[model samples]
Target: MSHLLELFRFCPVCGSEKFVENNKQSKRCNSCGFINYINPKAAVVAIITNSEGDILVCKRAKDPARGTLDMPGGFTDLNETAEEAVIREVKEETGLTVTATRYLFSLPNTYKYSGLNVPTMDLFFECDVQEISNLTARDDVAEAWFMPRKEIDPEHFGLASIRKGISRIVGK
Candidate 1:
């Protein structure tokens, strides 16, 4: 939350040079009286399990946790539902189509990117892949693989929300 205030020097609504912080949640424009609130972004997190109960994981290729373990999901685009976002992200990163999904949970997380702490609400879903075999990593993923649930280690995940989500998903 502190990151949002620090990044904005002027009011976005009125372009006024004078902007005042009303609280940790919002900023007020002195010129136009436009109030801006810091809202967490919506992101989808996949908990893909195979017939053998192994979990699909992606090796991140970007920062804020590059080279670390992540699920096959990403931020939602405009006008896309959470379910649609998960399906699209899964296909984009893993080259697998999502046949179905079940909502599991949501976790709040902070992603630091380019010197900004981006707040995100990670909406988790148990995604069903049409074909587990012959999967390839793409987009921001460098590699993709599956591991037994028993061998899953949340500590290996780079994001705090991912760690917690893995723990909850694997019953650890």
Candidate 2:
């Protein structure tokens, strides 16, 4: 929030230069009384598993965690539901079409991108994929593969939320 306060010097609503911190999560414009609330973004993650119980993981191609393992998912787009986002992200990153999604859990995350720490609520789902045999890495993923649960290491995942998610699954 300190960074956000530093970044936003002008009021977005009135174009006033008197924007000031109103609270921990918001800023207020002295000229127009407009309050800007900083909210966490919505993201989705798919817990894809093969029939043998191996978990699907992707190698991140870009930074903030490049070259590390991640689940197949990303931020939800405008006007899109979390379920739709999960399915779309899975297809975009792993070339696997999600036929169904079952909500599993959620975790708070801070994604550092372009020098900004973006807060996010990561929604997790167990997804059933179609044509699982046709897996190919795409988009921000450099590689995608399934690994046995026993061989999974949470420490190998770059993101904190992903590591926690992996721990939860491996502990199960």
Candidate 3:
């Protein structure tokens, strides 16, 4: 009951008030012996760059880091591969289609959504775009622009995972 998920008071299966901590990551319904696990979510990020190697960046229009710099990407849908998710999210948010991918690295991030701290495994990929003239800002993006390699300061990005990724890119 001391967990942050204090709103989870009753058993989901039998409406019993006997749900107890089974482990660090799960709760158990003592009545039905049903256990629910809180697992880290899967997310993807597109590290897209133009012909001059200027990275594509987005300004967030939503909370958690509104107006801060970000890359083109989002959480993966159920049963979606990381590759597919990168393609879909980039198209939805940046209007750019991904033609190729170069795996970069993975980082663990804590995404604050709706006051709940959600743990996520963020998969970063360097995406290839055939055309850049057709790209535009949409979805949760306030604006989209290309940042030159020298100007891509990690401190400008609000997400810790993104900062780490950029630091790695800049050999920090």
Q: lDDT of each structure?
A: 0.90, 0.92, 0.88
How displaced is residue 89 in candidate 2, in Å? Answer: 0.4
Please, what are the lDDT tens digits per residue for candidate 2 over residues 53-107? 9999999999989999999999999999999999999989988999999999999
Q: What lDDT does candidate 1 reach at residue 159?
A: 92
| Tens-place lDDT digits, model 3, residues 1-172 | 3554556778888988999888877789989998877788999999988888888999998878888988888899999999999999999998998999888999999898886778789999999987889899999998999988888788888899998988888666
Lowest-lDDT window of 10 residues in candidate 3?
1-10
Candidate maximizing lDDT: 2
Per-prediction TM-score to the true structure, in the order listed: 0.96, 0.96, 0.93
Tens-place lDDT digits, model 1, residues 15-130: 99778887876788889998888889899999988889999988999987999999889899999999999999999998999999999999999888778788899999998878
lDDT: which is higher, 2 or 3?
Answer: 2
Instruction: Report clash pairs, candidate 3.
Output: none
TM-score of 3: 0.93
Q: Tell me how candidate 3 scores on lDDT.
A: 0.88
What overall lDDT, based on C-alpha atoms, would model 1 receive against the true structure? 0.90
